[model samples]
Target: MVFRRLLGSMGVGGPQVDTVLAGGAVVPGGTLSGQVCLLGGESAERIEHIGLELLARVEAEHDDGESEGAVVFERFTVGGGFVLGPHEERAVPFSVPVPWETPVTELYGQPLGIVLGVRTELAVAGARDKGDLDPLVVRPLPVQEAVLEALGQLGCGFRSADLEYGHIGGTGQTLPFYQEIELTPAPQYAHAVSEFELTFIASPAGCQVVVEADRRGGLFSSGHDELSRVSLGHADAHTLDWNAEVDGWLRRLTDRPAHQPSLGHQAAPYACAPPVHHDPYGHGAHGHQDPYGHQGHHVDHGHHVGHGHHGHHDPYDRHDGHGSHGSYDSYDPYDKDDDHRSGPGVGTAIAAGAAGLAVGFVGGMVADEIVDEIGDFFDGDDD
Candidate 1:
C-alpha cells in the first residue's frame, strides 16, 4: 500500500510524499525495507527530515469506557536536509528493523485480524505532514508458526484474535498491549477446558509460549482460567514433536491448583489443586478419557477463508479516533485463492482426532454458519 500526500499541512502546491512497503509479509524481528518517494509541488521547499512511525490501532480501556486509537510505538528518521526544486522527484530508501515484539498479523499467510501500519512523516519547509497510511503485514516467527500449526493439527479451531490493552502479569512483555489469539478447544481438551488463548513473546533467545485455558468446572464445580508458560529454543522447533509437547503442557496446567505466587509472576487461577509436579503430558503415560468425559478432537485439513467471506455485516466504529479503522482492508496472502497454495502447508502435519466431529485449525477458516453468527453478534450490538 502506498500513501501519497501533497503535504496537506502546507499551502497549495507543496511537496508530495508517498511510502511504499515492498510487497510481502516480514517475520518478527526481521528487516522491513522499502522506499519513500517525494515529489516537489509548485515551488522550491526546504526538506528538514523524512521520518517513519510504526503505529498500531490499539484498544485502550479506562474508567470512562473502552475506546480505540492509533498509538505511535516506534519511529525512525529515514532522510532529510535537502532542497526540493519545483516538480523535483526523489526516492529515499530505508531498511527498518521490525521490533521483536511486533504482533503476528498472519499465520501461514492468513489474516488474524490484527492491524498494524507504517506512516511516513515528512517535514518540509517548517511544515510536517504524516503522509499516507500503509498497511503492515507480519508473518509469524518459525517457532511461533510451529506452535500454532501444532495446535491446529492438535484439533483446536481459531476463535477470534484481538489486541488487549494491558500486559499479562508474569511476562517479559515489552509492549503495553499484547495480542491474544484465542482458539476453541479441540475435542480432547473440551472436558478440561472450554477454550484456549495463546500468546507468544518472541526474542533473540527464544519465545515464551503462554497458553491460557478456560477450565470447565467438574460435576458440581465452577470454571476458572489457568495459565502456563513454556520456553522453547527457536532451533528446537525442528527437532521436537510440538503436538505432544503442547498436549502435555495443557494437561499439567489444567490438573494443577494455585501455589505461592511467583514473586514477580502473575498467572490466572483455576479450580484444581496446586500442581505437585510439572509436565503432565510427559514421556509418561498419556491419559485416556472415558466415553463420558470431554475429549480433545481435531478434524480434517481445511482451507484459509478471507475476512470478507466471514460475512462482516456490522458497521465499523468510525467514531473510535481516526476514521481509518473502519476502512482497514483485510489482506491474507494465503487467502488469494488463485491457482496455487503457498509453500507446502508450512511443513507441519495436523493430528486430526476422533471421527464424526468437525475440526478447524488455528489458521483454517471457521465454519460458515459460526462465522455468520459471530458477524451477526457484532452487527446486533451496533443496532
Candidate 2:
C-alpha cells in the first residue's frame, strides 16, 4: 500500500512523500520494483536521498521469553540527489535485488501468515523521515517448489512457517534470521517420526536444504531429532530426482542416531531438533520476539535433539525455533493459482495502492498503529 505523508518532522508545509511498490509476488533472489512519489511543499527543497528497506516480522527465543519486532534485513538507496521545485511533483522509480534467502510468505495461493514489508526513507535538507511501509509477499523459488511438491506427494502436510532470530551456527546464513517451514509427518514415517522442519538457505550457487526430523524413540529410549543436509542447485529444479532424493534423506534420518546430551554441543551438523517449539516461549505466532532474546542476547544452544560424545550437549548451534499448522484437506498439486494470481508484479503493485493501507492492515501489528497515528497526527483527525 502507498503511504503518503508530509515529513512530519519537517513541520507545516513540508514535502509530501508516498511510496508505492510495483505489484507482483516476488521470488527469493528476484527483483522488487516500486516508485517513490515526492511532491514539493511550500517551497523548493533540496532532496538528499530516497531509500527502501526490506523488513520482516520474526520470532526470537531466549532466557526470559519471546516478543515481536520489525527486523530490517535489507536496505537500498534507490534514488537521490535531486532538487524539488516548489509545488512540483516527481516519481523516482527503482528495482532492487531481494536476498537469495528471503522467506516465503505464501504457498498454495494461501497466506502462511508470514509478515514482510518495504518501508521508505526520504532525506531532505539534512533531515530524514521514514515515509511509509508496504506489505511484501514472497513466493518460493522453482527449486523450492519442486522440493515442497515432492514432500506433498509424499503425504507430508503443510503446517505453519516463521522467521527465527539468530544464526544457524555452521551454515553460510547471511541474514540475522532464517525461515523455517514446518511440516507434519506422512503416515509411512509417522511411526518413526513425529514431524519435521525444512529450512532452505538459498544462494547463487544452490540451496542448502536442511531436513530436521523429530524422531519417535523406541520403547527403550525417548524421542530425539535427526538432521540431514543436501545440496540442491537451481538447475536441479528440472533435472534432479526430488522424490527419490527426499526419500533418501528420510531413510537416513530414521536409520541414524539423532539425539545428543542437553549440554554444550553446538556446532557443525546442527541440532536436528526444533528449538523444539513453534510458540515454545508463549510468544504470539506472528512477529513473536523474546524481548530478552534480542540482537545482543546470548542464545542458549541446547535443546532435546541430536547426539554427541558429551551426551549432554545439543548439536547444530544457534537456536532455531519454528511453529506449524496441522494438516488440511483439498490440495491441488497442479493448481492454477499461479496463472490466476496477478501477473509477475501486478498483484503486489495493486497492494501498493493507497486504499488497502489503513490501521490494522499489514501484519496486523503495532506498526500499523504507529503509521496510522502518524497520519492522523498530521491530518489533525484524532477521532
Candidate 3:
C-alpha cells in the first residue's frame, strides 16, 4: 500500500510523505528495506527527521475480557536534518532490522489474519505525523516454517495463530508479548488431548519452542493442560525430524501436571504474562520462572457456522504481557472467509483426523469492531 498523506500538521502547502516497503514478505530477525519518499509542498521546508515504526495488531487481556490494539513494537530513524526545494521530490532508502520476536503474519505467502504494518513518521517545523500505514507481511523464519510443516505431517492441522501480550515464566523470553499457533490434535492423540498451542522465541543463536496441550481428564479426572519446552538450533530445523522430536517432547510432557485453567477455558498458566520488557536483540540477564507462571487467559467465541459449513466451536485466547496473567494475541473466531485464502489452509485439512474429525478452521469473514479497525486502517486514519 502507498500512502501520500498531505502533512496535515504542515497546513495547506505542506509537503506529503509516502512510505513504500519493498515488495515481498519479510521474516523475523530479518531486514526490511524500503523508501521514504517526500514531496516538497508549495515551497521548501525544513525536514527534521524521518522515522519508521513497526506496529502489530496486538491483543491484550484485561479483567473483563480481551481487546485488540495497534502496538508500536520497534522504531528506526532513517533520514532527515535537511531542507527541500519547492516541489522537489526525494526518496530516502532505508533498511531496518525486524525484531527477533516479531510475529509471523503469513504462512506460505498467505494471510494468517494477523496484521502488521510499517508506519512512516515525518517531522517538519516541529510537527510530526505518523503518515503511511503499509501492511507488513512477515513470513516465518526458515526454521519456523520447517517446524510447522513437520506438525502438518504429524496430522496436526492449523487451528489459528495470534500474538499475546505477556511473558512465559521459565524461559529466556525478553519480549512483552508472544505468538501462539493453535492446532487440532492428530487422531492418535485426540483421545488424550483436545488441541495444542505452540510458541517460538528466537534469538541470534536459536529459538525456544514451547508446546502446550489440553489433556482430557480420565473418566474420573477433568481435562488439564501439559507444557513442554524444546530448544532447536537454527540449523537443527533442517537437519532433524521435528515430528519425532516434537512427539517425544509431548510424550514426556504428559507426565507433568497441566497448567491451571480459567473459569471458562484451559489457561496455560505455564505461559503467563509478567511485567513488560521489550527486546530488539541484546538479551539482558533474566530469571526463569517455573513454566508455572499463568501469563493470561484465552477468550473464546461461542459456536460458529461459516461459509455453509459448521463444526464444533472452540474459542481460545492469546495474551502477551509479563505474567500478570497474560496470553497470546487473539484469532478472530468469526472470520468466516479466512479459510478460502490461498497458500496453507488455516482451517481444516483435506485429510481427516482419527474418527474422521476434520482439522483446521471452518472459515468466516471478519465483522463488528474488527471490520472497523481494518477498514479505517486501509482507508487511512489521520491518527
What TM-score does model 1 achieve against the real structure?
Answer: 0.68
Model 3 Cα lDDT, one tens digit per residue, 192-233: 778888898875556677787777776556776666666665
Each model's TM-score, in the order given?
Answer: 0.68, 0.69, 0.72
Q: Candidates sorted by TM-score, descending order?
A: 3, 2, 1
Model 3: CA > 4 A from native: 1-3, 254-383
Q: Pick the candidate with the highest TM-score.
A: 3
> Where is model 2 poorest over a 10-residue stretch in terms of lDDT?
322-331
| Tens-place lDDT digits, model 2, residues 123-241 | 88888777766677787776677777777667777666777766564566656678887777878778788888888887655567778788786756656665776766555665657
What value does the lDDT take at residue 69 in candidate 3? 65
lDDT of 1 by residue, 347-371 (tens): 4332122111123333344434333
Model 1, runs deviating above 4 Å: 1-3, 63-65, 257-383
Q: Where does the lowest 10-residue lDDT sum fall in candidate 1? A: 277-286
lDDT at 329 for candidate 3? 16
